[model samples]
Target: MSAVYSVKEIYIYPIKSLAGISCQQAFAEEMGFENDRRWMLIDAENQFITQREHRILSQFYPQISDGKISITFQEQKHEFSAYEHLDNPVQVNVWDDKSEVVEVNESTSKWFSEQLGFECKLVKIIKPGDRKHESSRLKEIFNVSLADGYPYLMIGSQSLDSLNEKLADKITILRFRPNIVISTEVPHEEDDFTTFKIGDVQFKNVKPCGRCIMVNNDPENGKLKKEPLKTLSKYRVVNNSVLFGTNIVSLNSGIINVGDEIIF
Candidate 1:
């Protein structure tokens, strides 16, 4: 049979809740895309900080090249090595999961603090396997990065197109922050995808992603708008939560490209 859908875009958020990097290709790791959400910001209490709390975070753009990761904010740039060794392992909280993370360094932490105007530290997940999925609904244990939950999120491009048709001001897929964007003619078809393959990697669709206020934030200017969510809630609300996209877990490891065929 001919391919029903094709991969349209791939994204990786090296730092949780920060602007993501769009790539032509990415390696599918057990936890998530390689170098994806491997680094994150934590406050003095070692609690994870996200765009939900600080909308300014959306203004910080990240790029990964060679062995270095660079972030640009307010016309300034900061770069750090992809790998670093730290002497202390600090306990950090990501939602309900607590895991030990290695602090990047005092200088990196200072840079972030200055950028966000708050005391925060940059930390990396030393061992992703140390933080396993805690849901009992799944029969197997899986490793995950600092993502809200699940290792992958796939959304049908047509779904966003459908949602846009209902709103006066349309939005882009970046607002949903999906890792995998599949081009399909049908809207919301991914919600029915239980198991599927892209290239040689297999993935299982787990649950519908519940929308949050963070989706209303303008990725371009870090400004909040009472949109998409307000309109989405009119029709997409379920169990009192606005729903869009679907969370997935990788069943195998491989590389996925932008134009690869999605086999269901």
Candidate 2:
């Protein structure tokens, strides 16, 4: 399918590793939203647990209110105030192969366990005092992010609807771990959007997003299904990445809205 040249929609997930809220306007930095995905969940060993491995995480919807974060799932919900400064935090590993993280407190840990019915802890990464983004490919681009990988992952709305239509069951769009959601007038046009502008910001396409089991999780219900992933595996495979959305590098930073017009 060919793309139509127009903007349709935009969205952002405030908290990482949980269900996201649709946004009309969001501030964009080089990596993504200023605080989006800035904090994460780590296991006992401080290893990062994500939707890719833990599908149940998709069930929780997270929202930020008055400097606090509230998470809701099933019939249970909880709101916790953000710590101004965590005390006695231990250094932990976010991944087995990459990323070390600083742990939060046990009070934060109990809050998450109550919500998810599991023993887990919450932690925030202290922003690196001295870190730099030296992309071997895009040397001129400034990369400053707390994301597990890459600065931003943008997905087209039509691309998701197209995928869900193929499945016999209705699937929510949250399965794919995207940082930005854009609606383009052209059907399936985001696949070829090399350069596009949202508000005053412009983005350069870096590569096609690679997909994984994360796409199969039901964000609202936290259930694992096999049909969609099975279907996508048959056709969407590209190199090593599953090839769903397009990975983009920021050209200009600005605010993007849900109804904002995208210029291609």
Candidate 3:
């Protein structure tokens, strides 16, 4: 029998660059999955901070419960109201995109400052109009959350399995930090998928995600590694950039769950 392709895992990073929480199901939104990358950390200059610069960010763990989100770093834990709306708007930068975001609160910022050992503030995306994903291929612009670029990112399980086979040290899929993981026999098959569906929702596969130095930062040990990126560069290089998961944009909003069949 041909290998069955289905949604195996779902994840959401409520705060950009921090740890993600796995879920059995996720609500698809126009910008991204509900609560995915809705929050982010910015320095004193309002520039975004990520694992790319501070590997310790991988050590921060966030958990959602009882209408509140709690983030823990070492022995310190801070909780925030799940849907709290702070009206303090501030200009922030994410990559090349600059937009106005709502400053979460002083206490949240202080908590992060203590953890990262530097001055930083936590902010949330309150207005979708503040940011848009400019696409040369797509006729219409797409709204995005605080994610690097695209709204959704997907990787086939076999893709990681294939990469791990070539490395002396095996790495887990969490290193990839994808929102959606699909089970497939053929590695990198998602690269060819232009349009597909999960359950009843349609998605347009826009482009292959370019692997960055952030992937080198191991999520568990919070240390840099050279296996996967080193191996991927040897064979997966395209246009002088190493490529991995495929970025997707939702064409419709709906509920997607694990075990949902992926229709190409």
Candidate 1 per-residue lDDT, tens place, 1-264, comes to 343799999999999999999989999987889988888999988889988889999999998879899999998899989897477888877777777788888888999999888899999986767577775656766788988888888899989999999989889999989899999888888887888888899988888888899999989898999988988899888889788999898878899999999887
Expressed as tens digits, the lDDT of each residue in 1-264 for candidate 2 is 244443343445544577776665678877576557656776665566687777777777878778887877778787676544365555544322233344456676787777656777776644532123444445653444545455678777777787777888866556776767766554355667678787798988776766777677777677777857887777787765567777777777788776666676
Q: What is the C-alpha lDDT of each candidate?
A: 0.87, 0.65, 0.89
Among these predictions, the greatest lDDT belongs to 3
Per-residue lDDT of model 3, residues 211-232, tens digit only: 8989989999799987688889
- Inter-residue clash pairs, candidate 3: none
Candidate 1 global Cα RMSD: 1.4
Candidate 3: segments with Cα more than 4 A from true spot? 1-3
- For each of the candidates, the C-alpha root-mean-square deviation to the true structure, in angstroms, is 1.4, 3.5, 1.5
With a 3 Å backbone cut-off (N, CA, C), the pairs that clash in candidate 2 are 4-186, 48-94, 210-242, 211-242
Candidate 1 is scored at a TM of 0.96
| Per-residue lDDT of 145 in model 3 | 94
> Each model's TM-score?
0.96, 0.81, 0.96
Clashes of each: 0, 4, 0
Assess candidate 1 and give its lDDT: 0.87
